[model samples]
Target: MEGHKLGRAPNFTGACIVMFGVNLGWILLLLFAVYGLVAAIFLGLVVNHWVSWLEHRKQLADQRYGDVSGDT
Candidate 1:
């Protein structure tokens, strides 16, 4: 049998730091995804409400003043 050569153990601190960095990267990515989804939903809702409000205002204006279109 060949004699086994002993080697120094790997650096535990470096390994731990690398693992922590990987985990932190994943966590940050997940948080950003959630934040983006929420922001998109909020923006969509605001735009929807704004469009509806504008339509309502236009309707009210039309009712108050007959179609000003000279085509009449």
Candidate 2:
């Protein structure tokens, strides 16, 4: 098929570079989101453990000192 040239053919090198950049950007963004999600979950677990430990210590203290106060 004899086709007339449209203005100018698109540059293959430029297209490839643009696509590579876009894919790299998306990959980086996805990695960052996953890292943040994992970090948040880890921090939440740590906080929960810390709170439980504090509660346990408080209970132990009260159990030991409760006999001395006659304020039942």
Q: Top TM-score: which candidate number?
A: 1
lDDT of 2 by residue, 1-72 (tens): 368666886759878979976975675567568787666566556766987999798778879877464545
Clashes of 2: 0
Find the number of clashing residue pairs for candidate 1.
0
lDDT of 1: 0.73
lDDT of each: 0.73, 0.71
Could you tell me which residue pairs clash in candidate 2? none
Collision pairs in model 1? none
lDDT of 1 at 25: 62
Candidate 2 — which residues are off by over 4 angstroms?
1-35, 67-72
lDDT of 2: 0.71
TM-score of 2: 0.44
